[model samples]
Target: MVKMGTFFGMSLGAFVFWQSMDKVHVWIALHQDEKKEREEREMEVRRVREELMQQAQQRDSVA
Candidate 1:
């Protein structure tokens, strides 16, 4: 008696694995870029609001 194991064809397995990894890489990259842009926008908004508030306080103090 002999025992045999099942194996996938090599090229097909490689291609399917590569495709799945590529998709995941693309998704992660896009998500990271989106988060960075959102953070930058929020920072800019905060900076502008702070500047305006400081100016208002200075003017009120001088009055």
Candidate 2:
């Protein structure tokens, strides 16, 4: 009887541990995706700013 109880307890603990780890893995994955998106957006903004600056410089030279 005691052995059965121990087995049950160990099984429950393992299940809970795996579930928590799965959640952590999912959270990390989501954060990584968000970070990638943010970096891409920043790069796009920088490109736009560079283009605008170039245009301004050209106009100044022409004037």
Clashes (backbone N, CA, C under 3 Å), per candidate, total 0, 0
lDDT of 2 by residue, 9-35 (tens): 999999999999999999999999999
What would the per-residue lDDT of candidate 1 be over residues 1-63, giving only the tens digit for each residue? Answer: 122222445666888999999999999999999999999999999999999999999999999
Models 1 onward score TM values of 0.79, 0.96
With a 3 Å backbone cut-off (N, CA, C), the pairs that clash in candidate 1 are: none
Clashing pairs for predicted structure model 2, backbone only: none
Worst 10-residue lDDT window for candidate 1 reads 1-10
Candidate 1's displacement at residue 45, Å, is 0.7
Query: Whole-model lDDT, candidate 2?
Result: 1.00
